[model samples]
Target: MTDSTAPRGGKRERLVTSAGERLHRKGVAATTLADIAQAADVPVGNVYYYFKTKDDLVRAVLEAQVDQVEAMLASFETLPQPVDRLKALVRRWDEMRDVIARYGCPFGTLASELDRRDDGLDLEAAGPIRRILEWAEIQIRQLGQPDARELAITLFAGVQGGALLAGALRDPNLMSGQVRHLERWIDTVAASSTQS
Candidate 1:
């Protein structure tokens, strides 16, 4: 018999996608298998067939997030100039200001929540953010910044801080403002590189 829970893709894929979205909105500890099943339109018992445990599902979600971050970074690389690439990244965030204001940065909020749990997957949960930071470092390095790594950290922190504040205040403008400031900072850094 064909499974009703299965979508055009597959039940497992749907479950993972549902879990990731729920986890982003509800967090790891709070999101239950039942919630994922409901979101995916699958039976609760069928969830166990795909993921033996909640941790297993969480790992899958993190892997999906890593893939998303890689794809985003790859898209940024298509830009001709490093500064333009970084600006593209900022613009990307600015475009998501509404979502960020509602739920904050998925990776940042998830990492913070998982870190607080002191669970073994804390590092795993942080993998996506780390990759983003490393990608930013490479972009900054391409711009010939002597402190590429430090500047990347600053950029990541600024984005995360803006995400946190925007979510707290429910203000999309706050995130847009931060994105504009970051774009200006990128220009300043680029100019300094030329002068030095």
Candidate 2:
């Protein structure tokens, strides 16, 4: 970027955004620079100008996802209670249930695929997931629970598992059910936390 205020609607950003779409739809190994270039409406040669290699594009997509997650979490902070913030997070995921049913959880799918490789990207792949779970832990702790970390894990694990099954079965309703159950369950946890 030329400056912090520069509009990110430029070719480079298009490439990264297009790459994220393709990667989420068609996994990393299957998406080519040409595919991203075509999707972004940039010439194949121009892709090399913005990204030296395919891995560079993948890393950029991961970084973009991290920024997205942070911005979203920051937005959730505006809610009054920790439980409300937590439900908002789940609601956010619920909003994407249809897409997740079609393409799986982008974060989970990409992270799992990258873990099979020896490249340093495996660590980068964990960045967004860690941030989400860590954010959840903070919220759970605010409920005055000593087992905040465990509860956070429980929350994330259940959601991720729901996403996986929703994708595998190509059923958005499955995710809807899961999220509804989760919201009710979070209420139960919150009620119990304050009591204990």
Candidate 3:
């Protein structure tokens, strides 16, 4: 018998975690609400109780992903050195490999899926991602140029490209290479901005 409060603490978390994993592994198109319900060991109706629809579940999963990254970035921001923060970001990303391997990056996969559609669901799904990029822009600006926002967008694009390739090639190493390339570019840009 489950504890009465288990639904809010354990069961709800399990459903979201399972849904995120499924979304990462198979993407939005292939994953079904029933699949998440089964993976989470929650009844189908219970899953619906937590999430009104499949899209709602997906949005929540994406929001969770964004929140994790945002927390990492926030911690890095407190470190006092811009370059160190950048390096910390990379390290945090490296730590995400297992999650990436299991369910892909929710932001990358969901953004790709939503690109082709113009529905409210797609727009709603993109909110967290947009906020992330916005925050990243602020960080990038601190590192150098007035147009740091654009640089943040570029970095986000590169990461997504790397993730997409990782899924397609079935090799996380591809993501490593892409991130290395991004690091180099960031270093050069940051250095140049400091000199100017």
Candidate 4:
């Protein structure tokens, strides 16, 4: 589904896109408006027209990420089984293993940095993560797990922790190994539920 809130390739969109990438790589504090302008090929003066402050730009980025998370979870709903849908979650991270190894999770890194402050942006930054966790919980519930919340939390922790380790160590293998383990765990859960 198309998101009207999504940036649509104009100067503002370009600025938001650039900011998102830089925020993921260099972080919010380190990424200047000038840096985003240089990346988007827009003049620094023009960025202010779209976003008066860096926080505004970060909000736009978070909005886009929330939409993305929704889209991804919706896509997984097309799968034949809840177990396959759950496995698709880990597979997504596996597909982006190299990029994640370099910069950590896009939503995760931004949220981690923003969470250090008492600002409400902490909740905003975590929107995508919260969405994913909620989606996983539902999928686990579909699999008939009595403790779906706990299972989903374990899955979220494993994926995020794996991403953290991969990024910290600059090794994609950690993410790969983590996803493999998750695949097995999902199978076990699915099998146990069937036998129940």
Clashes of each: 0, 0, 1, 0
RMSD of 2: 1.9
What is each predicted model's overall lDDT from 0 to 1? 0.87, 0.90, 0.73, 0.90
Per-model TM-score on C-alpha atoms: 0.93, 0.94, 0.82, 0.94
Candidate 2 regions exceeding 4 Å error are 4-9, 194-196
Question: What are the runs in model 4 whose C-alpha is more than 4 Å off?
Answer: 1-9, 194-196
Q: What's the ranking of the predictions by lDDT, best on top?
A: 4, 2, 1, 3
Residue lDDT tens for model 2, 39-108 = 9998999888777788988999999999999999999989989999999988877899999999988888
Q: Cα RMSDs of all predictions?
A: 3.2, 1.9, 3.4, 2.4
User: What lDDT does candidate 1 reach at residue 2?
Assistant: 52
Error of 3 at 93 (Å): 3.5
Clashes of 4: 0
Comparing 3 with 4 on lDDT, the higher-scoring candidate is 4
- Ten residues in sequence with the least summed lDDT for candidate 2: 1-10
lDDT tens per residue, model 4, 38-149:
9999999978878878799999999989988999999988898999999999999999999999999998899999988777888777789999999999999988898999
lDDT tens digits by residue: candidate 3, 112-147: 686677767666667667876877777677877788
- Per-residue lDDT for 127 in model 3? 65
Candidate 4 lDDT score at position 19: 90
